[model samples]
Target: MPTWRPLTPNDITGLMQVANEIHPGLPERPEVFINRIALFPAGCLALEDEDGRLCGYAISHPIRRRCPPALDSVLVEISADADHYYVHDVAILPGLRGRGLAAECVARLLASDAAQGYSVAGLVSVYGTEAFWGRLGFRSVVVDEDLASKLREYGEDAVYLERVLDSQ
Candidate 1:
């Protein structure tokens, strides 16, 4: 059986291992990652196996609007309705891919948000992953020329996507 929990300090090494699997060629310096842990530890979640080995992981946050405009960085521009949660940078282990684990993780995260009274979610697909995200109910948003350049700088082929969560 597998269990999930928030990551802790001792789990940093393991978390970095998992992160590297998803983002190859990323810097491996512990200090750099330590800064990330300090900044958004609550956003990181990990899955453990029966043996207590870290099998998978995911990151989530309640998309804040006080973000600086940066290319490639996620920006959570919520609609005026203000009843949505935007998901970002969701990844599962390669060995664990195609098992619906990503979807399960997303579902659990969204459920938690709904329990907290949120109603929708959104994210930006980096690699023209519209079909994959479409399966999760995220539709692409149209963008103008300047916005398109900014997205290119951020290394994304497309703009944002959003999914409205079902009420429990």
Candidate 2:
């Protein structure tokens, strides 16, 4: 069975390789991953397959409500006014998609210390993945002008989705 572990700087190379294969059109720089890992290590994770190979990764952090960072952009710092947990990115290798790894990773992330206190978790669902995210409890919300512009950076089909994280 595949499992998720804390991502370290050393995992970036392997993580990027899988990211490229999985998201060729929507590429993010290594610095972005580095920034996220540096900003909130607890929210950074690497997925290791049965043979202990890096197969995927998840990047998340707290952010101001409705202000998901643009794809491939660097953050100077986590928002000081952060009121939400933003699921920045979660990618699984193609072959591993249907095995429930993405859902498992999401559940783990939502329960992490970094995710605590956030009333909701939000993500910019790219690659026509709104339905997939919806199955995980996210629902698309109408955006205003400022946010609508930000979503443009993700691509035409990008949809902003969020799920209430009922406190435990």
Candidate 3:
């Protein structure tokens, strides 16, 4: 079993390894991960096995509705009045699949955001993984022309999804 904890600067290398394994061809520069942690430490998390080896990571933060930051780009700052808690990225290594670590990490982040009074959660699904996020209660939504154009940077198959969170 693996335990989930807040991500620290020390976990960057392991985080990149998992990111490469799960998100091939996606932009996952170290500075992006570092900045995410700097901006929202609580929303950035790592999963570690009993031996204390990191196997996965999740990065999330508050963002304005219908607006997701561009891939591989760093946010100057997170919006304090943002209406949606956005799941920017989550990845688990191939060997660790089917063990529910992904779900556990996402659940923890969503619950934490809900407790912080965010009524909605959103993610941009790529790599034909919309069904995976759908299983976690997200529903696909048609974005306007402008937002759809922004999502294209993630890849041709990128889909936007959102879910209303139950008040904590």
Candidate 4:
């Protein structure tokens, strides 16, 4: 079975490999992952096997609603008064699919103490994966003109989704 742990800088290369495999034609810079880890280590997680081989990763952090960040860009810091726990990206290795590892990763993330106090979770679904997120309880939301323009940077099919979390 795979184990979950906070992502480390050493895992950047392996994370990039999985990202490339899952996010073709999308821009995902290595520095962005590094910055995310630095900004909120608890929100950046990795899954590895007993042999310590990385198989999956999830990058998330608190952010303002309706203000999804752009793809492949770096942020100096997360918003201090952010209201939503934003899932920036999540990917599992091809060989590890069909085992519910992705759901496990998300569960771990949402349950983390860092995610506490947030009443909502959000993510920008790309690659027609909105159904996957929808199954996870996220519902499609219409974006404003400004946010819609930013979503275009991800791709035409990208859609924003949000889920209201149960009160803690």
All candidates: TM-score: 0.69, 0.96, 0.94, 0.95
Tens digits of lDDT, candidate 3, 27-138: 6799999999998898988989889989988899989987888888888998776988899988887788888888888888988843377888999999999989999999
Cα RMSD, each candidate: 4.8, 1.0, 1.4, 1.1
Instruction: Kindly indicate the candidate among 1 and 3 with the higher TM-score.
Output: 3
Q: Which of the numbered candidates is closest to the native, going by highest lDDT?
A: 2
lDDT (Cα) of model 4:
0.88
Clashing pairs in 2: none
The better candidate by TM-score, 1 or 4, is 4
lDDT tens readout by residue for model 1, 1-168: 566777566776776677677666333444544443455565556787778878776655554321213432433332344444645456566776787777777777777733245565667576567788899777766655655664565464656667767774
lDDT of 4 at 43: 95
- Candidate 2 off by > 4 Å: none
Per-model CA lDDT versus the true structure = 0.60, 0.92, 0.87, 0.88
Query: What's the CA error at residue 110 for candidate 2, in Å?
Result: 0.5
The deviation in Å at residue 113 for candidate 1 is: 4.1
Q: Which ten residues in a row have the lowest lDDT in candidate 4?
A: 64-73
TM-score of 1: 0.69
In model 3, where do residues sit more than 4 Å from their true spots? 113-115
The window of 10 residues in a row where model 3 has the poorest summed lDDT is: 110-119
Better of 1 and 3 by lDDT: 3
